[model samples]
Target chain A: MSSFEVPEVSNKQVIFKNYVVGKVNDSDLEIRTSQLRLELPEDGTNDVLVKNLYLSPDPYMRSRMKEDYTSYVPPFTPGKPIDGYGVSKVVLSKNPAFKEGDYVTSFTRWEEYSVIPGGNGLKVIDTSESVPLSYYVGCLGMPGFTAYVGLYEILKPKQGETIYVSAASGAVGQLVGQLAKLAGLYVVGSAGSQQKIDLLKEKLGYDVAFNYKQETDYNAALKKYCPKGIDMYFENVGGKMLEAVLDNMNKFGRIAVCGLISQYEKENSDGIHNLSRLISARITMRGFLQADHANLQPEFLQKMLGYLKEKKFVYIEDIDEGLESAVGAFVKLLSGGNVGKQILKVATD
Target chain B: MSSFEVPEVSNKQVIFKNYVVGKVNDSDLEIRTSQLRLELPEDGTNDVLVKNLYLSPDPYMRSRMKEDYTSYVPPFTPGKPIDGYGVSKVVLSKNPAFKEGDYVTSFTRWEEYSVIPGGNGLKVIDTSESVPLSYYVGCLGMPGFTAYVGLYEILKPKQGETIYVSAASGAVGQLVGQLAKLAGLYVVGSAGSQQKIDLLKEKLGYDVAFNYKQETDYNAALKKYCPKGIDMYFENVGGKMLEAVLDNMNKFGRIAVCGLISQYEKENSDGIHNLSRLISARITMRGFLQADHANLQPEFLQKMLGYLKEKKFVYIEDIDEGLESAVGAFVKLLSGGNVGKQILKVATD
Candidate 1:
């Protein structure tokens, strides 16, 4: 325990300035610097002091910035460091399960240093894998598992069946398209830009990709792509897209409601018109949380690692330089400025 | 094979004049009398000529009036007698399985006589039960099975859980509330009129009932009734009611979409705005057809009959006098004028 000396450093944090209303901007959060000791306090016998290397900037983080919204996760407090999924190195640990130099992933703060309580949500990652440590905050993390659950467990993709994914170039959507492809499905993805559409088609191996911003009629676009009708829809951007998807869904179709990023920012939601199609088609639409499916995490991680090794799954990350850039990165993410999983590189390995 | 001789009769039929665009009216159908031989033709070896007694006018019939709407059942053609759940007496049969004077229920037309193809959807009722023959067309038939499948198979209500049923005094809604009450659930129902509300609370055993038309804010009304959030929603009238229910739903709530009567007549559906709540609450919304759950029919019948015999479950019917009243009955049923399962008595047994 006394092998090395612990150093005190200035901890940089991305703080939530206030509860955001309507569209989230960089001004919603502020950067603050504070002092932190590398060693645990005398009473912190079950805590691990970690230096955050990479922090995930997710669309769901925008949801947490609001004060009174009811969701699976609680809202972030103002004047405090915002918390999210981050990959970190255990610099000093009083917990028996964790030691110094152990690489782990947890719901840590958007800060350079964090003292995470042991055996709560902290998961030690396998450093033996040649994948980047930041992968734990993106592909090997919550977003990856969300896609797996939505595809295999919710929609249950069948071979030769058609699948349509909204926001398909994003973290979950990209993986969902790839997984549907691996299951021998006719996969089509919709994104906001030409670059994301290209990434979805060329890089992600989607059968068809469309820039939704360019399509005047979403229903016409979906009909053009899914000629046979959509058997499964991985719904990310809801509202008008969901309405169009409902119109193009086949009999006994399934919609896995992963996210509604399109509706999150708006004070009044863009209402869905064709929900009656759900009855005529006998569709099943279910919403789920990744935390609820923790039992499948080991299997998810194993299969994802294997897919990565075989080059069957390709991952992309849009990384900002430091914790100071988190607010800008998150604001950009919400506006669809970045493709794939957006991450803020807090520190180097 | 029979002592009584068959006689030729005038088949009085309610003919669908043309496909209805919006709300159906009496002008959309016409009563026509056609001559028919009571005896089956020698070549009609697999057909049974039945004298229709009672015909059920359901909300789903509105969907069939559309020129090109896809459903589990085919659309009713113009100039043809509309088909529905009917109780009939087999008057002439070339098929050996069904004999003359045998009572059967099938998808029969709004006519005095129908020559249904044998062994195709015909189910002979047990007349020994001492229940009314018209019950086979309403409470003890297709509507009953629909409620059973939705409550037992789909929602699977837990004791003490809260349930909200829309279109409360109608065919399936009445049964769903009764079933939920039988399961010890705190049941609340929403109907369009005061009479239906009274029927729900006083007659149908719903713990609370509201006239949805009278309520300015449905969410507030639901919140007042179901202080504990809705655990299961038996959806009958969709559109605004569904949107309100979504807002008042508890986490892990289940919604069994039986029918969307509110949206059937509208050209453009009233869009649901609060669907994003489905994700936050982790709701499971499913749409089902009674045909898909044929295996549960026998069990449903046994339990329903038992409940009826014990006076544990009450049945209601808004019976119209003759086949001449068919168009009026159907029109009224769509507008929520009928209190219970609307039945058109085509003939007396």
Candidate 2:
């Protein structure tokens, strides 16, 4: 289709009905159909009209659902389309950088069609035959870059060092464990279910994987898994996991605080009692956002692409079909109902 | 006295009775008299025998009283003389670095006389007419160097930033406030009593100081003092104070974990409920030891000596007389009973 070709189509969008509190339910989001003329505006010089293909359901989206919250990213506006990282196919482009039939990744709304303003935060995806296009929003995208920066930059992993990762089968945690193992470190991981633990050990190549749900004592579990003591901790689920990891950390250990998924849905967060151990063990804990690390994308893509081609990295996605399933998929993500990266397939290419 | 001269003297020493639990009491230590020959050992080329002048009663010493604690410094042996940072007058020296009548500072025991091995951790006092000898055990000693490294090296304070310090009127806190102020930053400090709060505001030049004992809610107290939100927090008394500080920290804030005096005496530590703020605010919290930054001492000394000479830095000391008062002073230090830096005046130079 040319930039001037217009078509009257029904655009289905997932709208944010109201601000959420406590646990999110599917009723919080409502799908509405609106008619959109699929064509560029007359003065659209730097805009790209894209057809959304896949939408990502991330834990960070939970923070954005709150009415009033302070975070690295802004909260979603009520009554507006929920926007997040998505893989889209450009149908009409007035921007010189993007052409018709080019697959691009950008922050797009949870709608079948989206008009994204050109500038920053837009990347044209390389359509390679080896990898799936949906992976752009997951393993090869934000989560992958997060794991790279956290392990290499923040943790500064050394060979033979021991690493412990919480929520170990999640998108970022899976990559963190694999990257640490590739760096010649002993890696241990914890997940919510036995199936996830099995996947972490069998598929992800983790040295040891434990189901946190089965362990009566989190501290004892950490001690059993990381016998020599944890040198680096990839903190995904905070609260008790953070406290337990602190107790098992070695002297001069480092903790990369990527996400606190456990406390995201709670009105009042659980208290971490073992924080004083950070002092006794002389630990360094730092929190970071992947958006701040855009400069490393090229390097991250090159290495990740190589690992993917060589079959050295493994990724799994629990993809839900259609925009109607997005709301349910997101709620399931916060409740740990979905395994691996939870993605919404909006439209088929 | 010559290095070969021997004198039979009855040396009164304070000995550690046993391992302590919870708060330290006066009964945990006992005074004993032992005969000592004030002469260098046979073929001892690097030994220096000295007469103890002043001994510092620090919070870190509380951890040393535990039976099998792991730290940068080892625990004090039970049924032996307790060792700590002290100022001493050299009585005999086999090392060329020291001679009789020269004042030196080292990790000396709580006794009238001590024989210290000479090479490392010992620095000869400049014997400047401007500063008092007792200052070596407080401001110009371990605590002083600790503040310098934490603020300049770790926190990396910039001008016009806001800083909050807990236990603000003590040895390290008072100096940290003054140094931060000199660096052109707004500083706030919190102490346990009104007297210490007044000392911080009136004498130490803190922009704001609060008595945490009077505050019904710690988070509200932090908001009142640090209205701009804390840019850097010098953590000393941890537990509740740390939780409150974390709640009020600005985006990209830094926390330098110096000591957790509140948790040191507790069998089970209080939980910190606001650690999740580290992720939203992109905070970096690191625990450090002063021994790791020996290379920065030369620059620290030059600047600190200048500040002392120019009357830009003010230090206060609660001097307790004799080794008999040492036990009471140490117990008092743990309970915040003594003001400023608590020190035992073993003997007057």
Candidate 3:
């Protein structure tokens, strides 16, 4: 009935230039089209072709630009397409593990088409109408897991404990506050702007939200909010905020250091002096990466999906369309321009 | 046997004059004997008579000078003799659990004689030839337990991890270095003077030792020694050393804050601006008191006794004879003049 013309094999990929030094420019990235077909290459082993639909512009991606080693995580190799968390659909599979039409989450390059090994980089997602599929990158994914593990596992927040989170309206911070609220904690959060603070209070449901920019002195602000003292601090934005939090922490307080967007672009980072407060308060401060919480993924997804289904949870998504806007969106995410999870939409179909 | 009249029971005790403001003076303390008898009150239920033998002159006693609520441990009541770890011989016990002629340790006041609750204070020490009796207050006591938990549990040091201990010749710092070395770690220590640095290197067996007093720039000194960056930092003298350590720490570096002796005397402590490094470095910095590590006591004693029996551990004591000299010894400990664990001999007979 139909003699089909072979589909034009033009693969569009996002390429990274030589490592960015200071504030990352859009010119640091270029979208180039490759003549290679979207089909999986005829390598004899298990490789699959994926049509990337959603790409995550995470703050930690900035770490890949640095050359030095950071704990258990390795820096991404330059001169190649930088890869991060993305939602994709399997187009063709040389391996039997994934079928021709299955939704999956993978660490793939910023591209419309990619070929990756079947076993290592792919995780299958069971979809439902309860929430949007893009939520796999936010609430039910890495960011949500990061919030859960950092708050519950690291901080071990007890009921009625006072909790403070920086970057309150950011992807991770927003979820952290909600979870803290669910745990019956007295929660306060710091955001970059009044709009974000309002969003944190009205949309995300933080007990108290303060625009750090409006607050002249962080210590005074902490004293005002906490009054008695903070029992747990979810540290995301470092610098003066951390110093302030340290001074107001209760005895045996806990701090879970998740990120530091403030100094990610700076050459010489700011120093905090009041760390001695850790001893005086007998605080336990721990740093954790989300990958360490893989074991909690099942529990995280089950709980988050249940919340979404019950309409008890609200998540904000700052979606930037097309691969061309990925670089700009990523820069904005780092600069705290975006309120929530920054997701770049590659294609709808 | 020569007939001995029971020592005339003067019930008076030492009194602290005013709250210690700056460096404690010998004149700040005055010893006065009271007309109270050594015998416990006739109706006492849990009372015991303890003739004080050895009392510890610890650095934390200096915190009692301040009225700040930031204190993790409660401050000693002013105008009363300071209380800390002490070794004593029981003379009488109204409580049946303890009896006469038993050697015990208690948080007793800095005085020759003390009547304590048998149930409330004191742990009987089984006399063993493994170590000296005074070792109970030094090596096998608070300092030793502190080093054990902070280095092993809190830091969770990996073999070959680079560890830096401040106040390397102090009671806790000295043991931290030794235990770190035994754990197959690369240890570096910083002390205030050249003599202390030499002691850290030669007697304490630290891999690299520095005199913080001689070094103009602490950050430069840290970078020079820790080229690969520090993995664990044992904080004692917190202020500038903490700031410098933060700058040089590797990602996921752990800091166990045991004491902040340098800031204890200051009314308004100096601001350390380098604390934000914890987020960038992804450091896990915790503060602890040794009394909280009671669960690990058995393990600590076993390991410490093994080390002591093999002569793998060596302890130094700065012993001040008589109860009257106790106040001066405490002042020296806070001023960093004492070479090792400061001890006060009460009776010794």
* lDDT tens digits, residue span A228-279, model 2: 9999999998888888888889999999999999998889888887676777
B1-349: candidate 1 lDDT, tens digit per residue:
2426656799999998998888787899999999887766678557998999999998888888888878778899999999988999998788888888999988888899999976467788888999999999777888988998999988988899999999889999999999899899999998888888988989999999988888959989999999999999999988888888999999999999989898888988898888878789999999998888888778878988999999998989999988888889999999999989999888899
TM-score of 2: 0.91
lDDT of 2 by residue, B1-349 (tens): 5645666888999999999888787889999999998777657558998899999999999989887677777889999989999999888888888888888888899999998876345689987646888888888888999999989988999899999999888889999999999999999999999899889999998999988999849999989988899999999988888888888999889999999899888987788777778888889999988888889888888888899989998999999999888889999999998899888999997
Off by over 4 Å in 1: A1-8, A37-40, A117-119, B1-8, B117-119
Instruction: For candidate 2, give fnat to 2 decimals.
Output: 0.72
lDDT (Cα, tens digit) per residue for candidate 3, span B1-349: 1225445565546677667676688887778776545566557578988888998888877777666534645766767876778898888788787889888888787777787865466888888654667889888999889999998888998997899999888888889999999999999998878878888888888999988888869999999988778999998888777888988998778889888888877765666654546655667888988777799999898889989889887887889888778777877888888888888888874
In terms of TM-score, the best-performing candidate is 1
Q: What is the lDDT of residue B94 in candidate 1?
A: 83
Single-chain TM-score of chain A, each candidate: 0.96, 0.96, 0.95
Score residue A314 of candidate 3 by CA lDDT: 90
Scored against the true structure, residue B235 in model 3 reaches a CA lDDT of 88
When summed lDDT is taken over every stretch of 10 residues in candidate 2 chain A, the lowest stretch is A117-126
Candidate 3 structure quality by residue, lDDT tens digits, A112-197? 87888753578777865446768888888888889989988899988998999999888899899998998999989998898898
TM-score, ranked from best to worst: 1, 2, 3
